[model samples]
Target: MAKIKTIIDGIEVEVERDSWAIDVARELGIDIPTLCYHPALGPYGACRLCVVEVTKSKWTWLATACDLPIREELSIKTNTPEVIRSRKMAMELIMARAPRAESLFPLAEKLGVTKPRFKCRDDIGNCILCGLCVRMCDQIIGVSAINFANRGHKRIVTTPLHKKADKCIGCNVCVEVCPTGHVKTLDDGSFRHMQTWDADLEMLHCLICDKPYIPAKQFKVISDKLEGIELKRICPVCRRKETVDNLRYAVVEKVS
Candidate 1:
């Protein structure tokens, strides 16, 4: 095992190499709050909540601890006044953008950020787009149906071609990973829609089953493909079972 040394909150601590900065900080009784940084999912560093000041030689820069790997002779400052200010600013910005959001409000309050300094934009009402939803879809579920479209301030997540996304696998990983409940699937196996006051839609399909279950709008597309197929009326699994049973009966009649 490689030995690593890092300074956190002005105190030096020795840790194992390949360890994440957040895990090392916790061992030293330092708390770095985070969302979208689940242990199981690893770190996407999208929330920007786990930012830390890292000093190496003459360079001092802000880095996300959740994404940083431990290295020898590294200096990390988790709770410096500057770091606290930056964290508060990030919280304020996220809060202003998603005021009524469930997860972020509690974290903002905990960080002692009560109000935003700048005037809140009317469009900043939902989904800060930290990339948690997109990452979960691409990384965990292996479905790239949802993605960040546009660029910079105008960047927003959407399906392919801004049309109903036929590539989605109907998995709810995006919904589960979304910090705000903006991405959600309905009861039917149709498409997932972003809950906005305006009408913006996204869609997905099942990879294995090939059933048009999710995304109601895309149902027509899938239905058209199944129009001539004998198994069109039922779902994929039921269709396969029916075919197997029919083949068995045909074989038995031939034997008789």
Candidate 2:
């Protein structure tokens, strides 16, 4: 791997080639505010909060630090006036989408965005369109139950036909990956519910104790991956107790 020499916020640093500007900035202790960029997932650059001014050769322009690759000799400014203005605008846009979202409010206060310039449309939750949930579902979980629909401003994340997909296993990967805490997962009775995708899954109970442990869909997916491995559908506590009893019985028989 080649090391690219770069200047970030007036400090000259050597960053690995093909690495994102945000990653390199972190290495030099530079804090670049980002809502969409997650280390577990690829750069989506939807938030536009990590914009930085770059000057290479005759060109000096703004680029998203999350997606921007450090190539060749470059001079990057992380907290320039231009960058701050762009970040403020991005924060305001996110605030307009999710007004009451507490996560958005903190970022708004930091960027000096008191009120959203854009008109309020609907009472959508704190989904900042970071795409972590969508990416985690499709790439990590291998379940494409939800995705972006429509175009431009009208576009929103939804399930197939805006109804819950049968493939949704109630894994809550979306809920965990969501940055703004928009998605909510509730375990009620024999079902696991996800509010964002409008998905409800039947819970699977332990065969021995009849205690609900996991969702039926999640169990099936895990069972499929485990080749030839037997699953008794028993809770961990019951399994341990059963194992101990069987071991004790064997010891008594051997001693006799």
User: Which candidate ranks first by TM-score, i.e. highest?
Assistant: 2
Q: Estimate each model's TM-score.
A: 0.67, 0.85
| Pairs with backbone N, CA or C atoms under 3 Å apart (clashes), candidate 1 | 168-205, 189-213, 189-214, 190-213, 190-214, 190-215, 191-214, 191-215
lDDT digits (tens) for residues 29-107 of candidate 1: 9999886687666777877889999989999899999999986688898887778878888888777777778766777
lDDT of 1 at 26: 83
TM-score of 1: 0.67
**Top lDDT: which candidate number?**
2
The global Cα lDDT (0 to 1) of model 1 is 0.72
Q: Please state the error at residue 81 of candidate 1 in Å.
A: 1.2
Whole-model lDDT, model 2: 0.85
